[model samples]
Target: MRTTDLQLASALGAWRRPGVALARALADAVGGAALDGRLRVGSPLPAERRAAAALGVSRGTLTAALDILRVEGWVDTRHGSGSTLRLPPEAAMRLAPVSAVGEDGAIDLRSAVPAAPHTAYQQALLRAAERSGPVLAESGETGPGLPALRSLIAGRYTEEGLVTRPEQILITSGARAALALLTAHLRPRAAAVEIPAYPAVLAGFRASGTRLAGFRVAADGWDLDQLHDAFRAAAGGVAYLVPDFQNPTGALMPDAARRTVARLAERYRVTVMADETMRDLDLRPAPSPLERIPRAVLVGSAAKTVWGGLRVGWIRGTAALVGELACHPLCEPLSAAPTQQLVAAELLRDPARVLDHRRTALRRQRDHLSGLLAGDSRWRFTVPPGGLALWLRLTDVRSDVVAAQSSAYGLELSPGQSFAADATCAHHLRLPYTSPITTLDRVAAVLDAACGGQGQGPRVPGPGR
Candidate 1:
C-alpha cells in the first residue's frame, strides 16, 4: 500500500473493529462490488462512517470489509495509512451508488467537503513525485514554491485586468492560512464582518483578539447602507466582505453596492478584505468590487473549484501589502506544499479541461440534490446561482429541535445559528450537498422524513413564517 493511502494514526481509536461480523458485512458490500467489476484499484472508498451507514452496519463492520478486501486482494491496507483498491486499473468498473447517510447513520452536511474523489489525481501526484526532488528544491533562495507557480498565479490577476508580478505573489497553504497571516500583521482593534460570517473566519479574527463588529447581510443582498454605517462606526481596522456567492445565505452583493462599500471603506480609511474563494464558481456572472477597488485584498483558493486536497491558494492586494503579507507567511506555514502546488499548477495550466469535468459532475450532483429537496415541501432553500451549499429554512421555527431530533436518527447537521454572530439563526440550517449524487439522495430522504413529509406535519413556513 502507498504511504498516501492512509493517515493510519487517525484511524485507530475511532475505526478499529474487533469482530469478524462487522468485517464480514463490510467485505460483503464493498467486496461484492469489487468482484462484480464495480469498485476498481486506485478508487477511494467512502469514509468508514459513511460506508457503515450506507451498508446498514457499524463502523467496525465497515473496517472488517476493508480487512477482507485486503486479504482477498481486492483492497490493500497501509499501517497508519489510507485504504486502497487492489484491483487493476484496466478492470471495467462502475461507481456503486452510496448514500451520504443511511437510515441508521449520521450524515454531516454542515461543512463543504466533497466525498473524496477516486484516485485519478493520484496519477498527477505520482508524476509530480518523480520530479519532486530537484524541482521541489530548485526554488533558489526563495525556498519551497518555484517561480513558475508564482508567475502562473500572478497571470490569473493580469487576466482579470490587475497587473501582478511574481515578486508580488506569495503562495500559501490555503485561504485559511492566508487569512491567518493577514490577521497576524494587523492590529486587532475592531473588525467588521457580515452578521452571519463564515464561522472559521470569525474564529480566526477572534483569535487575533479583534473586537468583531457585525454588519448584517440583507435578506436580499449585502446591506450596503448598514455596511457603510459599520465601516463608519469602526472607522478603520479591517472589514471582511464576501461579495459573491456568500456562504450561509448565498447572497450576492451588486456591483453598485460593492462600489459603494469600497468607497465607504476608503472614506473610513478601513481595509477591505474581499474573500473571493467562492467567486469563480458562480453559475452566473458575479460582479466584483475589486474591479474598481484595487486596494481590496483578494483571498482565493483552488480548494473550491478543484478538490480541497490541493491546498493551494493565493492572496492579491497592492504590491506593498502583498509583499508584507508574503513575508508574514514564513512565520505561519512558510509556503504551500511543493507536491500540491505542482498538481495545482498542472490543473491551472489546462483549467478548461478540469473545470469542464468538475462543472459537469457538480451540475449533476447539484440537480440531484435539488430534486430531492424539491420533492419535500417541509424545507425551503434558494436555488443559488453558484457556490457549494444551499441555505435551508424549515417550515417550523423549531430548527434546533429538528436538528437535535435528526441527530437522534444519526444525522448530524449545522444549525443556522452556528454561522451567525449572535446565534439568532435558530430557524435556519445550511445544507451542503458535497457528497456523491447517491448520498445526496439519502440525505434528502432523511431530511424529508425528519420534516414529516409533504403536508403531513407542520407546513414549512416561508422566510416570513
Candidate 2:
C-alpha cells in the first residue's frame, strides 16, 4: 500500500491557500484526504524528496508538514520507512454513524441518512422473530439472499414498470457493497461520472484505478449535451448515475433526460449503473429511470429508507448477470443478517405506510431548514422536491473556510469540494435536514455566527412538530 508521488500530489488537491501557512495547508490537506477515505491507513507516503519534487516544495517544508501530521496522529514514520497515513482514535470515531452527536454535542451534517421509523421497525422486528424459527433451522448461508426478500425486491421493480424476476436480484450487505461488486465485475477501463457525486463512490472508483470522465451536473439538472459527450468520449466504459433524486444536489432527472441518457448509453455501448438508494425518499411524484433503461443495473438500499443499521441492499439486473454476480469471487457468501432480512421483508410488504411516515417527517424537516436558510441573503438554494439535504451555494464565502469556521460553533460539515470528482466545488456546501427541528434551528444560528451574518434579517417561522 505504498502511495506514488503523483498519486499523493493528486490526492492533496489545491493545498495552497492564500493566508494559511504552507506547511499547515499541506498537513490539513493530508488529514482531509484521510477523513475522506482517499488515503487509506497503512499506505506509506512517497519519499520526502520525491514528494517535495511532486508538490514543488522544498524538502524542509515537506519535513515540516510530515511533522504536523505526526503530531496530529495522521501519520507514523518509522526509522527506515517514510510516513504512513493513519487516523487517531478520535478522528476514527468521526467515521462512525452520521446520527451520532459529537463530543460536547457538535451538530454533524456530514451524512444525509434519516432517523429510523421506530414504531414500524419494532413491529417488523416482532414479525421477524416469529418467522425466525424456520429460518434458524436451515444453514444461515442464503447465497443470493433469502428467497422471500429477493422476491419482494424483484416485485418492487416489476411494479415500477421494469419486469424482473427473483433470479434478477442479488442482495448485498449494503448499497456500497453492491457498487463494489459491480465495479469488480465490470472492470471498465474508465467511467463517466457526475462532477459532484457521492464522495465514497468517487473514492472507490479512484482506488480501483478507473479513469474518471466527469460531466458537470448543474444545480438545475444534468446537461444532456455534456452527458452525451462524456458517453461518446468514454465509449465501452461504465456510466454511474443517480438519476432519482440525486444525492447531495437532489435534482431529479426528467423522463426526457432519462430517455436521452438511455439512448446515449446504447449508442456508446456503455454499461449503466443507476443508484436508486434515495428513490424511496422522494418528497414528490417522479418517474423511475428503470422504465426507460431496462439494460441498466439498478442498485437500491434499505439504509436510507429503513435504517442504516439494517445494512440490507440489492442489485437488480438481468437474470444471467445476477447469477454471475452471485458467483463472483468478491461477492459475500451470505447477504445481510437473517433477522435483518426478515425485518426488511416485513417492512417492504406494506412499504407505502412506512414511506408515508418517513416522507412526512422528512418534508417537515426539509421545509424548516429551507425556511431558516431562505432568509439569509448570503446563502442561495432551491428547495428540492425530494431528498434528504439541501445543496447550498454560498455567495461570498468559500465552503471549506466556512466549514472550518463552523467547527468553532460546534458544527461538523462536509464542504462541497468533498463531493467533486476533482475537488473543485469550493463555493458550495451540503446541509442535510435529517436533524431534529431543534437541531436545525441551531444550524441557522451557527451558520450566521460562522459566516458573520450582515444583520438579523427576517427570521422564518420553524415548522412545528
Candidate 3:
C-alpha cells in the first residue's frame, strides 16, 4: 500500500509529551503505526523533508526519529529511497499484544484484567480433572447448558439472598455472549446503559442496532434520580445496570438505590439487565435483589472473580425467559467444558476463601496508590471500595491531552473519554492501581508530570455530551 506524508503526519501528531525529545516521541508514534499495520511493511514512508514539513516538525528532528525507528528494526531507510516498514505483512498482522512500554517504555495501565492467584487456580483445575466425568457422546451444540454447572450456580445464587433454580439458568460463553443474547431477545428500539459501561455492552447494542441513552454513575455512588430519568427516557426499551462495582468508576450501588432502580425499571416498564460480574469482587457485601424482580434479568461471570481466560458466564431469570435466551443464535453449548466447568465449580465451593484473599490484596494495593497520590494535586479520586482500577478526574488538565501525551512518557492510560456515552469525560482518566505497587510508584511520578498544566477543581460526573 502506498502511503503519504499527510497520513503519517496525522497519525504522529496525536501524541505530544512535554519534557520528551520531539524525535523520540515521533519515533514512538511511527513505530506504533508500523506495529499496528497502519504503515504497511512494503509501503515506503513519505519523503523525509516533506514528511517533516507536513508533520510541522524540523527536518533534523524527523531524521532523528527515523534513525530511532531504524535502530528498533521497525523501518529501513536508504539514502536515495525512502524508509519502509520492515515488519513483514503477515507478522505485523499477527503481532502480539503490544506492551505498554514496548513502544516508548511506558508503564502499562490500559489492560484491565487482574492477576489471579496461581496456586489456588491451578489446584482447582487439578481437582476438576480428578473429578472428571465420562466424555459424552457426539452431539451438536445445545444451549440450556451443563446440568451440573447450572445446578451449582443456582444454589450459589440462592445463598446470596436470591432464590434461584437450575431451570432459571442459561449458561453463556461469556459476559459478552450474555449481553448479545439479551440484546437479541429484547430487540430494543432504544436502550440505556450506565455511561462508561463495560465496552462489550455498548458493542452489543451497536451490533444489535439499538439507539442507546446514558446516565452517568455519580462519583460517590449511584444517583437514583439520574438512573430513573434515563430509564424513563428510554420509554419502553431496555436498560443495562452494573449496580455492583461498576467498571472504570467502581461505584457500588447502595441497597436503597438498588430497590429504587428496581422500582424505576418496573415503573418505566423497561426490561432491566443487571451485570453481576463485579458483585463477587466486592470486599464487603452489597444488595442482592435479582430474585425479586420478574422482568429484570441478571447475568454473572467468573471472569472477574476467577481467571479472566475462563469463558464461563450465566443468566438468571424465569425459566421461560431463560429458555428463550438460550436459543439465541449466538448461544452455544460450551457450557460444559469439562475442565473449565469443574474448575469454576470447585472455586465456587470455596468462594469466601478466594474472594477474601483477593479483597485483602486489592485493598492493600489501593492504599499504596492512594498514599502515592497524597502529595499530587493534579488528580483526585475517592478510593473505590473494591474494583480493578482508580477512576480519577484530572483537576486542571485535558484527559485527552494527557492520555495522548502519556504514550510519549512511557505510560499507556485509558482516557476517560472512552467510558463516557457522549465522550464528555475527556478530563477524567481510569488508572489501574491493580498493577504491582513498585510499578504504581513510577506511574504516580509520570502522572504528576503529565498533569503539570491541569487545572484545580472538582467536576461532578454527569451525563456527558
TM-scores, one per candidate: 0.72, 0.75, 0.71
Ranking by TM-score: 2, 1, 3
Q: What are the Cα lDDT values of the candidates?
A: 0.64, 0.80, 0.71
Q: Which segments of model 2 are wrong by more than 4 Å?
A: 1-104, 285-292, 455-465
Q: List, residue by residue over 187-304, the lDDT tens digit for candidate 2.
A: 8888899978999999899889898888888658998878888898779989999988788889888778888888889999889999999887778655334344557888989888
RMSD (CA, Å), each prediction = 11.8, 19.0, 14.3
The top-ranked prediction according to lDDT is: 2
Better of 1 and 2 by lDDT: 2
Q: Which candidate is the best by TM-score?
A: 2
- Model 3, residue pairs in steric clash: 101-106, 106-410, 106-411, 396-454, 396-455, 397-454
Model 2 clash pairs are none
Mind sharing the TM-score for model 1?
0.72
